[model samples]
Target: MRGLDDHTYRKRTAALKAKRHDCWLCGDPIDYTLPWKHKMAFTADHIQPRSKGGHIYGEIRAAHRSCNSSRSNRVTTVTTAPKTALRW
Candidate 1:
């Protein structure tokens, strides 16, 4: 994520809080009131990350904070290349 100003961050946070506490990616409920140590804490995530030209507020999603942080901006590869495939 880019260096967001405090005001921007707070504004975004407020908007997110008003939305339903559900994981936008998977449609799972996010228990924000629960303690983080209990593995049920909620977090705001960008559907498309800022590094990939995603708008912070326009494409936001709720997720387990840990899940969001762990995903970071790595592209997910579902299929592995064959070991014998020639190099490009």
Candidate 2:
């Protein structure tokens, strides 16, 4: 399959950066850098895996390489519990 050229990738990356200011998964700040910089490597992750009917460029989140890898294909959610008194 054909992949996006460097120019097209840059444009798309810039637009996505403008829309979301941080890593969508962990809420970490995104570092904008030159293409050659080591920190420039970022992954576009699917909020829901493609195997589960997710589409390319559909519901994506930008994340650091490590964070993206660690979060691979898992559904994340935040839950709250009622407060209870504790006994010593």
The candidate that wins on TM-score is 1
User: What TM-scores do the predictions have?
Assistant: 0.58, 0.56
The per-model lDDT (C-alpha) reads: 0.65, 0.60
Worst 10 residues of 2 by lDDT: 76-85
Per-residue lDDT of model 1, residues 1-88, tens digit only: 4556656876787678677567654456788777756555777677667788866565565677767767788543325432333777
Cα lDDT, model 1, residue 88: 75
Model 1 stretches astray by more than 4 angstroms: 1-4, 36-38, 55-58, 75-88
Best by lDDT: 1
Cα RMSDs, all models: 10.8, 8.1
What digit string (tens of lDDT, one per residue) describes model 2 on residues 1-88? 1366555555666676666456666666667553423443466666787767765555665666567778767775525432235754
lDDT of 2: 0.60
